[model samples]
Target: MTDYVSTTPGLFPLPDWAKDDLSDLKGHQKHDLISGDEGEEITAAYEQARADVLEVQREADLDRVVEGQLRWDDMLAHPLAVHDAVETRGIVRYYDNNNFYREPVVTGDLEFDGDVAAELETVSELIDDDDDLQAVLPGPYSLFDLATDEHYGDDEEFLAAVGDFLAGELEAFPDHETLFLLEPSLVTDSPAEGLDELASEAIDTVAAATDADVVVQSYWGALEEKVHAHLLDADIDAVGYDFVSNQEDNLYNINEYGTADDISLGLVDGQNTLVEDPEAVRDRTDWVFDQLPVAEFDTVYLTTNTETFYLPYNKFEEKLAVLAEAASLAEVTPA
Candidate 1:
C-alpha cells in the first residue's frame, strides 16, 4: 500500500486579529537593532499567528505542519527583499495572479543573513514532533528568474551565488523532516537556454545542505517537457506537480518520462475560494495513481496547487480539512 500524507506549501493568509495588531503597530515600527515596544508588539503578533496556524494544522491531522510563513509579507522575495545586499525595487506581478511582490535587485554578492532559518527556529519551538514540522523556502531558479541581477552580469554566476547563499542559510535551519522548495518560476518562466543543468546543479547545492527530504514544488501550471526532465534530474527527493491547473499535461509528462518513487500531488485549487469535496479529491487521486506507469509509490503528498494566501482565512481552513479527509480516503484503498 502507498502512504498518503496531507500538507500545505506554506504562505498562509494573516488572521484578522494579527492584521489589526500589525496595522496599529506599523506606525511605531522600529529597526532590527532597536528593541522598541512597537517592534516587540509586532513580533508578538506574528508569534501568535504562527501558534494559531500550527494548531489548525494539528486539528486537521496534516502529516506535515508548517508555520504558514506569517512574516513573509513580500511573498517569495521576502528573504532577498529584506537582505542588506539586495535592493527592493518596484512591485512586480507574482506569476499570472493578482497578487504582487516587491522585485529584488541584487546589487552585490548574495550572503546568508539567517532570515528563514530564524523563522524555522521560532516555529520549531512550537511543534512537539520534529518529524511533523516542515520548512518552506524559494528555490534557486525561481529566485534568479524573479530578481534582477546587477552585480553578477552573467546568468550562471548569479544563479550559483543565490544557491550558495541559500545553502548557507539552510545550514542554520532547525531540524525538520521535510523541505518544500517552492519553484513556481520553473513552470511560469522556463530556464534560459543551456541553464537547465545549471539550474538543477543549483538546486542540488541547496538540497544537499539539509538532511530533511527535499521536494521541488512547482505551481501555476505544469512544467514543459524539457524543464520537467531537467527537474527530475535534480538531486531532490520528490517533484510536486500542479494538477489543479493542468492535470492532463502534468500526467502526460509523468507517463512519458516517469517520476520519482515519491511525489506530491497538488489536488486543491488555491486560487478559487470554493472548497473541493473530500470524495472528489479522493477520486482524482485514485485516478492519478491508476494513470501512473507504476502501481506503488513510497509517499504521495496531497497539497494545494499554490499558496492559499489569496483565499479568505475561512476558505483556507476549509481546504485544509478537505486535504486531510481526502488523504484518509485515498489511503483506505490499496493502489
Candidate 2:
C-alpha cells in the first residue's frame, strides 16, 4: 500500500478571534507587525493566531502542519513588498480572482532580511516534532511574473535575482521537513518564450538552499507541455497539480511525461465552502492512481487545490479533517 500523507500548502484562513483582534488593532501597529517589526500587543495576537491554527491541524492528526500564514495580508507579495528594496505600487488583481494584492515593484537590488524565519521560529516552538513542520513560500517564477522589474534591465537577470534573493531568505529558516514553493503564475500566466529554462534554474537554486524535501506546487491550472517538461528538470522531490481545477489536463501531462516518485494531489476545492466526504476524496485518489501509468508513489499528498484563505475558518478546518481522514482511508487500501 502507498503511504498517503495529508498536509496543507499553508496560507490558511484566519480564525474569527484573530480577525477581530487584527481589525481592532491600530493601523501603525498592524503595519509594524506584518512588516516583520513587532509590538508586545500585536506580537501576542499573532502568536495566539499561530497557536490556534496549529492546534486545528493537530486535532485533525495531520502528518505535517504549516504556520498558517495568518499575518500575510498581501498574500504572495507580502514578503517582497515588506522588503526595503521593493516598493508597493498600485493594486493588481491576483490572477482571475476577485482578490487583489499591492503589486511589488522592485526599485533596488533585492536582498533577504529574514523574511519568513520569524514565523517558522514561532511555529517550531509550538510543534513538538521539528520534522512535522512545513514551510511555504512564493516560488521565484511566480514572484517574477507578479512583480514589475525596475532594477534588472534584462528579464533573465531579474528572474535569476529573484531566485537568489529567495535562497538567501531560506537560509535563515528554522528546520522543516518539507518546503512548498507556491508557483501559481506558471499555470495562470505561463512564462514567455525561452524563459522556461531560466525559470527551472531559479527553482533549482531555491531548492538547493534547504535540506527539506521540496514540492513546487502550482495552482489554478496545469502547465503547458513544454513548461511542465522544464519544471520536471528541476532538482526537487515532487510536483503538485491542481486536480480540482484542471484534472484532465493535469492527468494528461503526468501520464505523458511522467512525474517524480512523489506528487501532491489537490483533491479538495479550496475556494468553495462545501466540504468533501472522506470516502469521496479517497475514491478520487484511487481514480487518479488508476489513471496513472504507474499507480504506485513514494508519497501521495492529499491537499486543497489552492490556499484556504478564501474560505471561512470553520470551512478550512473541515477541509483539513477531510484530507486527514481520506489519507487514513487510502493507507488501508491495497496496492
Candidate 3:
C-alpha cells in the first residue's frame, strides 16, 4: 500500500465572513484605512477564517494543513512587495488567468524582511503540532520573473540576490514539516541557456536553509527537458508536476527521465469548475504508477494542480472532498 498525503498549494479563497469584515471596516479597496479598533476586528476575522479552513482540511483527513494565505492581497508576490526595498508597480496579469498581482519593483538592495517569517510563526502557534503544518512561499526565480529589478543591473546578480533573500526568510521560519517553493514562472518563461545549473544552484541555496522537507512545485504547464533535469538534480526532496494542466507532456517526461523517490502527483484540477470522480482519479493515479519504472518513488502526494484561489469556496471544499476520497481509495489498493 502507498502512503497517501493530501495537501494544497495554499492561496485559499476568502471566506464570506472575512470578506464581510473587510468590507465593513472600510471596503476591500481602501484597506489602508483599516486601523485602530477596526484593525483588531479585521485581524480576528482573518484568524477565524484560518480556523475555518483548517477545520475543513482536518475534517477531510488531510495530512498537511496550510495557513490558507487569506491575507495575501497580491497573491504570491505579496510577501516580496511588503519588503522595504520593494515597491508595487502597475498591476499585471498573473499567468494566463484573469487574476492579477501588483508587479513588484526592486528599488534597492534586496533583504529578507520578516513578513513571511512572521506569518509562519503565527501559523505555528495555531497548529497543535508543528509537523502537521506546511509553509508555502514563492520561488526566487518566479519572484525575479514577476518583479522589475532596479538595483541589480545584471540578471544573474539579481537572481542570486533573490535566492539569498529567500534563504534568509526560510532560515527565520520555525521548524516545520515541509516547505513548498511555488515556481510557475519556470514553465511559463523557460530560461534560454544553462537553465539547469542556474535553477539548481538558486533552489539549493534556499532549500539548504530549512531542516524541513522541501518540495519545488511548478505549475501552469509541463517543464521543459532542461528545466526538468535541473529540478531533479536539485537538493530538494520532491518535485511536483502540474498533471492536470499538462498531463501528456508531464507523463512523457517522467517516463523518459524518471523522477525522485518522492513524487507529488497533482491529481485534482484546481483551475477547472468541473469536479472529477473519485474512482476515475484513483484509476489515473494507478495508471501513472504503472507507467513509471520500478522503485521510482516511495511516497505519492495527492494534491491540486494549482492554488485553490481560482475556485469558489464551495467548489474548493468539494474538490478537497474529492482529493480526500481518492487518497483513502489509494491507501487500500495494491501498489
Badly placed stretches (over 4 Å) of model 2 are 28-38
**Model 1 misplaced stretches (Cα beyond 4 Å):** 28-38
Per-candidate Cα lDDT values, in order, are 0.87, 0.89, 0.82
> Candidate 1's residue-wise lDDT over 48-95, tens digit each?
898888888898889999979988767988878778888877889987
TM-score of each: 0.95, 0.96, 0.94
Each prediction's RMSD over C-alphas, in Å, is: 2.0, 1.6, 2.2
Model 3 misplaced stretches (Cα beyond 4 Å): 24-38
Best by lDDT: 2
Better of 1 and 2 by TM-score: 2
- Each prediction's number of clashing residue pairs: 0, 0, 0
What overall lDDT, based on C-alpha atoms, would model 3 receive against the true structure? 0.82
Best by TM-score: 2
* Candidates in descending lDDT order: 2, 1, 3
Looking at model 1, residue 19 earns an lDDT score of 80
